[model samples]
Target: MAAFPYYDTPAIDALNAQAVALLKLFAERGYVREEPAVLQPAEIFLDRSGEEIRRRTFTLMDPSGRELCLRPDLTIPICRQVVQEGRKFPARIAYNGLVFRHQPGEPHRATQFFQAGVELLGLEDRAAGETEILSLTIEALRVAGLKQFSLRIGDLALFGALVDALALPDGWRARLKRHFWRAGYVESLLYWLGHGDGKAKLPGTRAEIEALLDARADAPMAGRSREEIISRAMDRAVEAAALHLDPAVADAIAKLLDISGPAEGALISIRALLKTAGINLDPQLAAMDGRLATLKSLGVDPGQVQFTAHFGRNMEYYTGFVFELWARDKEGPVQIAGGGRYDSMMEMLGAKKPVSAIGCAIRTERVLAAKIAGGA
Candidate 1:
């Protein structure tokens, strides 16, 4: 039998050294470094993450028959620690570890990968917290010898605001937001609204019921009862089919759909669109505006940084201000570091109250690869 290959590569060792140095710098800045366990309960992920993530988790049963999973990400488990240990507010926690995910037909997507990140808990001021997180991420990249990267920032709260302002029905709003990433579905909505497809349809069985009742006025009560049952089922089916959206709301969403540009310009256009629709902007969003102004004052040009209005990472636990750092020259899947505010996760993990939080994870391999390519 052939033996499995065992090799120690210099590139891997250098990447590890770079990661350790970065973590040490974070620790010197008073961040608590943790080595989290490799295995965790499967329920922790399924309960907090979205369906797509849940499906991708690596799950198995233990010898004691409890279902367990390899840790897919470190944030949730760290939050769980805060809950179980009853940690205090404003905790600055950092972690470096390996995570696992099953990817079929995508061999390049490693089943196991390393992650390093920090979570700031119990900071209620979203704007201040967001700015700090962003700054820390930029510094981390620089310390790791990375330059020439652009940050793409976004706000999911803005998307929520658009949904609420348009007065879309609960179900349709949910469906639309859920599928907002799909261009075809969004276009279909526009087409439907333009063609007057918002009219509600009456079920066919209701007409049959009226006709039968008229023709057999003296029919037995049991036969009438049978028709009523069939009619009720048909009514439910009709209600289900009438899930089309309101035309005005559709128009509002269509306007929102086109909102993407440089940060300042996009904000101006969005505010105008909301005002024209008679919807007031949320005061909390003003904080984000203020932070953006601060960044501008600090010489980070809005034109250089792409600000997407409806942008979101795949994580559902993120509550605000998600961002991804991408190297300028990298083309495919160019995320070296990413994180966002996840204030509610600790409470969901059974903490006494909401612990405000923000975090970012650097894919160490990608960071080193970019650095080498840049001749660092």
Candidate 2:
């Protein structure tokens, strides 16, 4: 496949047929089909979706001089629409459309791709919400003729629970949680905490601070008075300089990140690891168990699920229960679909209060290819 895919008549017909089937299934399941705009405000994605989206987004400036972007994914746009419309709770929304991303060098990846999925907004039942989306996603793929794949699951809430149990300083906790999604960064942070001096220095040294103060004497940055900005920098400098993580605490985080395997065994290992570290996450662990049970009840085989401790799906908005479904193409294993619970995103998108949101989308191209390869 090229970055800009060229579909012939047969390919086009197949995709159209698959899309119709998906839309029909969604309607039967009580989802109202929604068509969010193809272009969205760039800032919303850049600020909330994390660095991966920031890098891939195709940004443009409209004639009005406002920055806009081709939506990199459908979930954010759909959620934003729901918030803007003041929709009632537990909104069952479904959509299928072409989403754009810049995949410059990867010919196998499309710059513009057809995606179809559902978003369940304002649903407070966490376990039930996750089950509904995941099971529906599986059914959608099956209807599109997919046969073999495995589910990879992770929970940011679980990781947050572990961090809270460690009893670290506020600054250290904030730093760890903020960079949780970046690859290799957490390991580097752990190493720095263990080896470096306890004190951390801000970028503004005494001379630098004086220069900045002189330069900004008549100006305020982002509504912050010069005095206020300098004061905050100084305060954070003091707090950061005093921040340090205990070697035991760092070790605990390392051990947790190291645990990953079959889902049930991973849960057992996490429990044992927490016990040895003298940290109790019974409530959190029980919640995870409940989700797994719910998944089983919804027809997902426990044997097909894998769990990893540090797998926060690169989207900063996801607050818990992230997942990806993978299938092998001729090259290797490729992710065909993914989504998770992003409970905090609604408030970030201007909702009056937090709204529970979960969704998953199939890469229609990949799923279609997989279906064809299986001679379905």
Tens digits of per-residue lDDT for model 2, 1-376: 6787899999999899999999999999999998978888999899998987889999999999999999999888888888988989989988889999997566567799998998999878877888888889888888988878888888999878777766568667777788888777887777666555434445446566668778767665888766777778777776665556677667777888878888999999888777767888898888778878876886777998999888874789989888888886666677889888889889998999888889888888888776666624
lDDT of each: 0.73, 0.82
What is candidate 1's local distance difference test score? Answer: 0.73
Candidate 1: regions farther than 4 A off: 1-9, 166-199, 202-246, 282-285, 297-299, 328-333
Best by lDDT: 2
- Give one clash count per candidate, in the order shown: 0, 0
Candidate 1, 244-284: lDDT as tens digits: 44555566657766677677777777777666666776664
Looking at candidate 1, what is the lDDT of residue 59?
A: 97
Model 2 local distance difference test score: 0.82
